[model samples]
Target: MKTIRLFSVLLFALSLSSALSQAAKPATVSVNRIGDGPIITPELDQRMGGNIQGPSLIKVPKWIENPIGQYYLYFADHRGEYIRMAYA
Candidate 1:
């Protein structure tokens, strides 16, 4: 009886810890730089997502440009559609 009680307590504690760990996991998010520059930050990266509606901006690394240094700002919806605004 004592052994069974100890096992139950241990199991309960383990389950609780597991639940807490799962809850502690960080949420994932998509990020993009708004305005007229490149976004370079982990927080921004996490915040980026599809369906982004904003102005024309340039993404970093320089090679992704078409000699004009401009890219449309947009986000992908859950359906993976690119919703972007044109540069004016």
Candidate 2:
């Protein structure tokens, strides 16, 4: 009986926490249009250079402190040898 009562309280607490949680939505967005500069520039770094491929980017959330600009670009070498970053 005591075990069941504790389980019910825990279940109720979990449900209430889920109900209070909300999905995050960004307040501002920066879109790269079709004619905008190439997302991957081959000459970003000549030493570790290979044709820059598979670009991934993340826009900073307002609540987070980003020392860089509004968005960040991240990419890795094909063999996972190196991961590089850029800010914009």
Quick one: best lDDT, which candidate? 2
The reply for model 2, stretches above 4 Å from the true place, is 1-37
Clashing pairs in 1: 30-47, 30-48, 30-49, 31-48, 50-75, 50-76, 51-75, 51-76, 52-75
lDDT of 2 by residue, 5-56 (tens): 9999999999988877864666895665787587676676675567565788
Clashing pairs in 2: none
> At residue 5, what lDDT does model 1 achieve?
100
Question: Each candidate's lDDT (Cα)?
Answer: 0.54, 0.77
Query: Which RMSD does model 1 reach against the true structure?
Result: 12.1
Per-residue C-alpha lDDT of model 1 across residues 1-88, encoded as one tens digit per residue? 9999999999999999999887966789788656985332224544445334343454534765454435544434444444433332
TM-score of each: 0.28, 0.52
Stretches of candidate 1 exceeding 4 Å from the true structure: 24-88
- The ten-residue window of minimal lDDT in model 2 covers 44-53
